[model samples]
Target: MQLHELEVENYRAVRRARLSFGHTTVLIGENDSGKSSLLEALVRVLDGGAAEEPPNFESFQFHRDPVKHEIVGPIRIRIVFREREAGEWAGEVYAPIHDLLLRAGEDCREVAFELRAQPEGEVVWRLKSGKRKTSDPEVLRWLREFTPAIHLRAGMLTGYGTETLPCAPGLCRTGETELDEKIAAIEVAAERLISKTSPNQESDLEAGFKATRELLQLVTLPRDRKAPNLARRVREILGKGIDLNSSQPTLPGSNTSSEKLGILLLIAALLRVARGAMAKEMEPIWIIEDPEAHLHPKSLASISYFLSDIRWQKIITTYSGAMVGSMPLSNVRRLTRRRGVVTEHRVDVTQLSGVELRRIGYHLGAHRGAACFARMWLLVEGESEMWMLPQLARLCGYEFGVEGIECVEFAQSGLAPMIRVAEQLGIGWHVLADGDKAGQTYIDTIRRTVATKDRQGRFTLLNEPDIEHCFYKHGYAKVYQEHARLGGKSTRDMDPRRVIQRAVQTLSKPDLALRVIEAVAADGSPGVPDVLQKMIRTCVKVARSQSK
Candidate 1:
């Protein structure tokens, strides 16, 4: 069951925003964007408060100074649940959900929720102020009186170091219960493998016998079939009577300490799995904060796949693009915060090109395979190129990734952050840049990044200040392959070299030489020179609209 959509009003940094979330949503943004704030609100509203508990609003950052005298206001959280019948997504639109539902509505399905605030900033999730003496709100009264659910920590995995977990006992790395479960499962798995080698039971007899005995002992039952002579009879059957008496065995084994720790870790995992089984409602949406933190690349990859299977609608937060790229494209959520109110967006990778392509490349590599991926990287100036160049590479039909050809738009602010992230990712990179003089500075910055590579293989810098120039320089042989659908021949003669000439000819802002370049590159068809010239004028109008 999914909390298909959210409508929050005047809650924390989010004053009023309505959003639709996929079953598995990856909530991402720079720091202090309302990602966490949004989750907290949902958890509280979903919790269906039992007793009066005031929401702590101290941490909420406001875009405006709320009236000091105000209180007793309404903060509404509306979650829509979708019902799917057979292959189609059906519907029974409920206001507030009682619990998570896979296909909408409780099995006995009843849904209505209402919450109100108090004058002193002590928001009463249920209802009432004695002076007002009104009856409890109908919606809140029903939910509070009849059905309710446990509000999970929006992020159960918040702190990186603390071992405490929310699900169950022995879930912590050092928990004992987890260890026992692991030891049992491991024995089962290992013996299953061992049984393969010893089809006749000669090689695995002792181990299998031990496992059977231990498993029996774990549940405090007797596997020996003899009640009185428990230890003695069991030991004799395994042919280890002497060692049993000595309280030690002579056998190849993993260290007890290591195995014990491993068991605890195993149990912790099992407990989390069990949490779903035990939930009173639908399987929970596991909210995670940087699940990639402090884990090995291989482990992170495995975990990434596991998380993808969680099936619970999720909201994963991260500061690292590695985690972002490791995630599927459909799940790439980009939360944008402006002024003080926070909003969300899906990073539509399809619209990105050139530099944006590289950013995504870094994101994919960093998220999936390595926390620390390729070194020295190229930082592009825009997101569009990052979005499309993989298409460019595909058009050229060159297989890209395996050859270590990774690139990403560093960030549009400047080449500085891009270079820094590359340095952090430990990859040396060459940059393809715009033709303007300022771009030279970006080029110099990138050249310095690969200062260490063997001088010959040092850095591969490819520049065409603009793709048009790139089109201009490499037009003959590859142009057809790159923009294959281009119906016309190259219009190199009409190409504008300087920003000023194109600006003067095109009534548009002559200031942006790049616009003229874009116009020429838009078409490669014959007799398209008129369109190219017109494109310059169109681009100028576009620039004017943008400035306005």
Candidate 2:
């Protein structure tokens, strides 16, 4: 089962906040806008692994964290999620977080954690640091089993520890490889640069910076900060070039290809070993943070697909909304904090209207790019209807939040698939389809398709247009008759009105009144209220005339 949402308190930059999580949630904001802090909280909440007992913000990528700036004391992190059931949302699904971590700060009490789970649901939380007087066994079990663990931060670059190059002779320009004097010689050049230009102590500054620049050009990776792994690889390679005599592929270039290929092989081999090492019983919560550290967009795209293919649940956090946009919307939510409160702007990725869908495609360099895993589907009868619905929904305070909703031409596939997908992700699904001919057919289909005994059902199929029309959208004969008598612009759009009137003709006054109110509200205009006032008077007069 997938862990579906999160909440937090006093966690680094977030003094008090809550977040709505999707399966593949993209936490987007300006750097240090509490994005990484929330991620750290997730790590602590799910896996209970915070390095510093008191939670140091600087070490976890919060450059300007108030705490890191030494302004605040110890902090806390809380995460909450429900598990996914195979068929329905009956009561609650179970996905318990295991392991609890807390670091004592200079200012706060010993962090306390109490875990509670029931047939209803489970909740895990820790109090301000208190250094428990006595340990709770249930809490201990919760920490051991439920907490989700994240093994790697997305910034890795080397095969081994950063100090490997410096320690091994001939590994750089001079001589460092323990195996060969050639590696030891290569180490000399790297050491020369490290001594001259190292950002940190005992490292080559010029060599590291040059390697960083070269990697960025090669992979389009952001160079906000330098890393030791990429730097060491660069110096050793430039010092000795590719050892084609020993290398099998016979690379085409000496400038970067060989080194790049070598690093790729190292990472690939390591990943395989790592994947294999994972226990068959251990279902890890894989969080790949900004995976584009050393690959092209195309390659990154493939990597995303690979991650999606994994059988276990994975929550990938990315800076690129476009990448998330390519995934399912049922798994997306915007992370924003206001007044020190984190509010999740939860939106279905398929919330994009027809126009927004076209615009996104344009921005992505394809008129209709189908390559991305996530897509937004637009459901409408015709182009004219699709054009007007978004405007209407917006005027009524419904902004689909514009991420990845696709506009499809038909309702059968669009409606059913949309609801089914949302059910799987445990996201809300609302069906607002056209109220025209065969409209009832679509509604009935949705009802029967998703109608189950499960509590908290995900699909909501609204019969939105019923109260507005005088007749159902079908019944052409009645529509033409009403159109001729009313002298409308045309009778084509009037058939459904006739059908609705006939359907409710024998109903009581209260029933008719309820339908009338629905119609007026749906017209969605200030003038509509006035228009409804007149339509009621007309209906009353017509009823009296029929009585006479």
Candidate 3:
């Protein structure tokens, strides 16, 4: 069974949200955007009742209306579970709820239940299927056991010890008999010692205790009872201790760094989940928060790979770009909060072909995955624009990093895929294409691909053939002339365009861009080009408007 979807209402910061899940779903958003709250809601609804005491729904768990300044009640969390195959229902764990499973589509069955917490603090669970609803505790129990949800909070790896390895069930199974025998031997020795120290023994102390017992016959005296055996309690503490194979045999949490411990814990959890599934004992769902916390980039990639390889349904919340880049764009759900309501956005991979999807994934997962997190994307042709445009934006008093604007170089990866991603995610984008034939092709592609209502303020074409030519045309002729002279070429009578083109061909694109930016910064004679300045302003305006 896999978690299919979650629908939440008036839960903490989320006024209402409906999110669908993939096998390995990643939740990403800004701080306080309700990523943690969403995970908490799932944990509460799935495992709340399993505890010895019922979970208390605190007042703050209810959503507060930003405008009204009042808290709302009756928080609702509904979850849907889909069977992986028709035979999954035949398993003994799911047999009790087999009749309640609803037909989702052809050959697909699903079961849904809602957890509602009323204002008066009463929580109720109702199973829903095709007009038949019931508050069956049996269904809830079956659901909890069939797919147990485990939440690993941020920084939890450091708190674990060798005796309590998260994956001990799968990792340790060989030393039980030896441990039990040793514990029994110790218990026997402790019993012998207790007998020798007992007050019931016929010693001088026993005689004194008997005399006292005669005087206080109504009260129970210590002489009549044997001593308690304290060694029996050692059985609970003496089990297999996991050795991490370091210089010193110690637990990961005690000796290892947080980053290494995180990786180890994840590997252990994956093993346990896999083994449990195969043994038909349990199918656990992991809710991991910030698996990339304090992890290096390489370590982050390792965790991402582990997550992708695991077959069990898991949800991860992360704020790392490298982590985001490692995941498929289709599996990521971007969250945003506006007007006290949390909303989710995701790429509609259905619109992409197999080839296009692979291409996009390769580019994003390899290099440009961070673009998905940007509020706006400035699509450029190549590295020249990627490097130069941000500097220009800075001169215009708009910093791309601070403004959450990512300059995506779309030369290697085509523009259509990026446009599709941006449109689906509601990220404002502006394409800066040159004025040559290729540039015109990009413009035509945008017109054909983008919606009519979304075309405004989304593209800018340079008046010149390229950025280099634009610099020469827009009163920055001296910038290139100086470069030509420095390169041992006299541009006394050459065309300004030719001079700039030669400089572009002589120096690498990035190096030449750096030279131009340096010259512009040093001389301060020709400020930012008018067209480029306007383009930056337009991008900022579009980005801000879309954010609102």
Which numbered prediction scores highest in lDDT against the true structure?
A: 3
Number of the candidate with higher TM-score, 1 or 3: 3
Q: What TM-score would every model get versus the actual structure?
A: 0.43, 0.37, 0.78
**C-alpha lDDT values of all predictions:** 0.42, 0.39, 0.66
Question: How many clashes (backbone atoms < 3 Å, residues ≥3 apart in a chain or on different chains) does model 3 have?
Answer: 0
lDDT of 1: 0.42
RMSD of 3: 14.0
Q: Lowest lDDT 10-mer window, candidate 1?
A: 233-242
Indicate whether candidate 1 or candidate 2 has the larger TM-score. 1
lDDT of 3 by residue, 17-83 (tens): 8888978898887786778778878887677237322345888889987878687667988998877
- Candidate 2 has an lDDT of 0.39
Question: Candidate 1 has what TM-score?
Answer: 0.43
lDDT of 2 at 145: 46
Clashing residue pairs, backbone N/CA/C < 3 A, model 3: none
Q: Which residue ranges in model 2 land beyond 4 Å of their true spot?
A: 48-76, 86-142, 145-147, 157-277, 338-340, 348-548
Q: How close is candidate 2 to the true structure, as a TM-score?
A: 0.37
Off by over 4 Å in 1: 48-74, 85-114, 119-281, 347-548
| Cα distance off (Å), candidate 3, residue 486 | 8.8
lDDT of 3: 0.66
